[model samples]
Target: MKVVKVNLAKNVAKVDIGGTQQWIRLDIVNEVPKIGDYVIVHAGFAIYRLDEKEAQETLSLFEEMLRHEAPLH
Candidate 1:
């Protein structure tokens, strides 16, 4: 999902999809990602924070997917 906002003090993030908003907590076990950085979120947890290269790759993949079809889950 797309990371819309990051709350560092709470270690949580606000993600949005199709106008639906959700809060995703960051895993304390993983390195804390900075604001504006994107991570792979699952359920309520941020499983893995993406590095620069990975984030770019992921964004590209997302764009490709969006180009193919409407976002439906």
Candidate 2:
């Protein structure tokens, strides 16, 4: 799945995946994520949020696949 956008408010986040948006309630027991972040969404919930580097890498791979780029080591 691809994370199209992230909207964070207070402690919760609304992650938009593909063309669908899902509301993820953050646990008050943990830290809150910032806006424009990428999260690992499952079952209408965001389990974890990826860092900027990882998010960039993921999007890069998606773009590469769309362009049919060869895998690099």
Error of 2 at 9 (Å): 8.4
**Winning candidate number (lDDT):** 1
Model 2 scores what on Cα lDDT?
A: 0.63
lDDT of each prediction vs. the true structure?
A: 0.75, 0.63
Model 1, 1-73: lDDT tens digits are: 5577888888788866557778889865277766566677767898887776887888789889889996677
Per-model TM values vs. the true structure: 0.59, 0.52
| Model 2 poorest 10 in a row by lDDT | 1-10
Candidate 1: lDDT of 64?
Answer: 92
lDDT of 2 by residue, 1-73 (tens): 3344444544456666566776676663134556666776566566777877887788788888889876687
After superposing candidate 1, which stretches have Cα over 4 Å from the reference? Answer: 1-4, 16-21, 65-73
Considering only N, C-alpha and C atoms within 3 Å, which residue pairs clash in candidate 2?
Answer: none
Candidate 1, position 63, lDDT: 87
